[model samples]
Target: MPQLNCIAPKPEHGSTSDPVEGGLSLTKMSSESQNKAVLAFPVQPKPLQLPLYPITLKFEEVVYKVKSEQEGFCCGGTWGTKEKTILNGITGVVCPGELLAMLGPSGSGKTTLLCALGGRLSGKLSGKITYNGQPFSGSVKRRTGFVAQDDILYPHLTVTEALFFTALLRLPNSLSRNEKLQHVEQVITELGLTRCRNSMIGGPLVRGISGGEKKRVSIAQEMLINPCLLLLDEPTSGLDSTTAQRILTTIKRLASGGRTIITTIHQPSSRLYHMFDKVVLLSEGSPIYNGPASTALDYFSSIGFSTSMIVNPADHLLDLANGISPDFKHPTEQSENMELEQKSLRENLKSSYEKNISARLKAELYNSEINNYSHTKDASIRSNRKAEQWCTSWWHQFRVLLQRGLRERRYEAFNKLRIFQVISVAVLGGLLWWHTPTSHIEDRIALLFFFSVFWGFYPLYNAVFTFPQERTMLIKERTSGMYRLSSYFLARTFGDLPLELALPTAFVFIIYWMGGLKADPVTFILSLLIVLYTVLVAQSLGLAIGAILMDIKQATTLASVTTLVFLIAGGYYVQQIPPFIVWLKYLSYSYYCYKLLLGVQYSEDDYYECSKGVLCRVADFPAVKSMGLNHLWIDVCIMALMLVGYRLVAYMALHRVQLR
Candidate 1:
């Protein structure tokens, strides 16, 4: 006897002791005397994982009356609606990590069974999927990984980047960057996606990787934390025989490594069929047999499904489950109306057909089991890894998310966009502000006010457009656990700061230069900050709108309306703006930006060549002595409030994934 210790096994030579399971392994530590299990393990965390709500599944006396015509829309005036019945009283058990494969034809209830397993069953399902001897409550989604038929991936992100991003969000802080990357790389290698490791998942226009690779990537993301149960919706669909075999091989490997894998496969190859540990044969929504794949023929034979000797055994097995296709021929003398009525009746009375078929199926199963004394295996559940909470702390999540947001800004070309915007604005600003030899009061006054009020316009448009693109990427990452929405909002605000500064700086310097509105450099810089600050607030508003709306179309429409209203209401009319709506002049982001723009419009804080108030009225147009209450500092304060308010609204809306 020897003592078993959970220790990180030593690697031979240059090989790393990195465990494939992402947890500790309990191995025998050989000594002189007795064998016992040690409490301590040589690992970062125990590689063992268990379901959050460990439950034993049982399907007893289940009679699911199946329906026909899964989809239909009610007509304006119709006697009744069309219908279809795919399954009747079908039932089966699916324990944790249990690989339960359902085999049937295209219209059979295999897909329905898969959906029911995931609690996605729609259209009249009357069976109870009990967990731990009780009806399932479906609070175990966090512990499950469902790989659907189509791989859900962001086309823009590469496999490694996507995996790393998922890990950074999903894995705990204890897992180092190298460890996470190692785990991700290990999955890629295992799934044979190493070649396309850096390739995009591809899309309608952008081609990057193969279907199987995409599927494997989906598995990789789901498996990042090693889920308790894996429910795959045709994990091997849309692949060639070899590719299907490889995919199934990976699935089996996962199952062999103590992961439960359940999938619905249609007409698997003979070799592929043999690889399955167990198969559930369903015909007309009723399970004929659900047990080991090895005794598939015997189970069929017991239920009077003797395979034709001439047919291939695999085809013979499938025919029992898929049903024999027989041509129907009616005599010319037969009543057409009666036949039509029969057809109509079949369509309308799908549930009756399902129940009848289901009853017959149960009878056949009971008889077969009785004659062949079938044995049920014990539901032996094991645990190695602990379940990690899906919801994370706001701050920790924020920091990680913010880092990602800032880093990913490179992808959006935000920094480049900002720099170019600022430099361009600066050049334009310099020309606008170029020395103006103005002696007359009226001309200088008009020139200064015009440059100041209009300076904030381009910043508004720039912020509005960029928000949409950034929002899209943010959504994909958020779903994949890249980070939280609040962190992104804050980072985005900060990230664009340097650029915001540059845009206003360029625009201010250029406009002042061109117009000869120079007064003081320091006052000019302060005004530039105000104008840029306005853009920041507006962009934040855009982010809020983007988050609030499910898609860009609505957001775009709303933004257009908003921009138009602000442009009109922000004291642009200066004189004719109505009294009651004067608040709009104050509330308008443009108003604040304009006010601040005017605050240092000329260039100096020196005495006015003109009287200044809200109007900055002066007999001399050029040299206005007064700095107007333009209320820019309030605008600054309000802009800050608006940024936080909009950002908060966007974050909450996005965090919930609120669809329009």
Candidate 2:
């Protein structure tokens, strides 16, 4: 083959190049070779020309405090907590077309301030935050998008699937599904994620896309809505230098599209640091320096903190934030002197920032507010554009979430280990019971009881881990106002039915016949329905406990104890109880379900050969008599109540989980 130079293709006529599998095709520059070559390198398409909703985010005197226990005579002479400040009068502004970075070490309240700006934080917050000269409103929330520090994505979902699902739920109801999907495509292209568009977003166990790509996917999810004010918490948390730089570059391009971008960065390399338009350096929850990125060094130097040419500005800034001079390296220095000097540096930085930057910023904010008031029409138009409306209908959200959940959880629900566990138990139970005769009333009762106990523990343990595993993802999505909690809860409650029922249906089909308890179709169908109903009730109880606790180990432990109690009082292992605790059987759903199963399998007139030739009613038998198969409808009604009741409890518990 002749020598050929592969040149990245540029958009023609201000439109993106024709997209290929992984990316756009590379154009051959050599005359000797006329054929085009395909290159897998991701080439960012021209920055999307999305409709700009210019937002000016401003916060004045933003203060956040948390309760700290203190031994003090307060609150009517009782010991009370004191308010501990987290963010101390932090103030700044990020206008449209600017990339502002909040730089600080751990626990400096960078994330807290970002959350306050995004309207995601609520606890003793005293501040005035505005978007487009208006206070933070539902309209502002709808227009703003917040990307969390961790990539809270479904590991099993492909890049396109994740963004598409986000778009389906988050995009306004005015837009058609096709239009929403088109937006997802645009975001994928704009972020240069076309190469990994079909790749899975992997977790710790399952390998999928790269770390950088996962971060981009997180960013892309927010970008799907074309948010005006985007707040990202440490978007480059765990990426390498090159990937981090690329991410910053992409963010800079986004800012160029007239979107106000605020991101919290723990530490950034010099090259990555320069990509930001403005920098806010915080120290111990106080603003040390707030100014242009290029002029941060000069501002700090003017404030009596200067760095040498060899030192990185970010490193030097962090050193100053820590109350240590960047040049301080004297190991033999006196400890008291170091402490006093460090305290003095912090005081000086805070005072200087207040006098120089904070005062000027306040004046600018005042003028901006005045200007915004003067131009009432512009403010009205912006407000009209940002007007909050239900993004998607409840039904639409439910459908989308249901589909996404099923797709994301298929592997977990049907993986080899889970399938093996269910199948092995089914086979073992089948062989052990192995078609017992109708005369063996005790054996049949034992088998039915074991069935109830198995489902009770099985679905409960499996479902208890649901919310804990998804708590972070849930918080992240809800904070963005993507979907109603009702929609998510309903979708989750119902979505797992098919996946959860499939195995039990199979198990019932196999074990019921293999054990040969009931040969009649009516009886078999009723038994199967009761088993499925019990599974749902157990799953609902698990959901409730998980939502109530939101801790995996704690929820699992509680679920185990609860199941053990239900199993014990289920009228199988223990029938007779003291009058005080006899009511416990009524509390156990297992008791009701087991009674229903027996009622269906054996009728009142059914009899078995108890003593070879002597016939006796099945109901008169000890195990059957204790359960008393009478009131079958009442038993089912009680189970039905539990099916709905437990889910309602789960929903109520989840509601108490603050979305803010």
**Candidate with maximal lDDT:** 2
Q: Over the stretch 102-199, how does candidate 2's per-residue lDDT look in tens digits? A: 99879999999999999888779998987656677666676688888888899999999999899888776655554455567778888999899989
| Best prediction by TM-score | 2
Across 364-406, the per-residue lDDT of candidate 1 in tens digits comes to: 5444334322211111111113222334456766666556545
Model 1 CA deviation exceeding 4 Å by range: 1-90, 96-98, 101-127, 130-142, 154-157, 198-207, 234-242, 264-325, 328-395, 414-516, 580-583, 602-630, 655-660
Off by over 4 Å in 2: 1-49, 71-79, 330-337, 376-388, 658-660
- Give me the displacement of residue 302 in model 2, in angstroms: 2.2
Worst 10 residues of 1 by lDDT: 1-10
- True-structure RMSD for candidate 1: 9.7
Model 2 pairs in collision = none
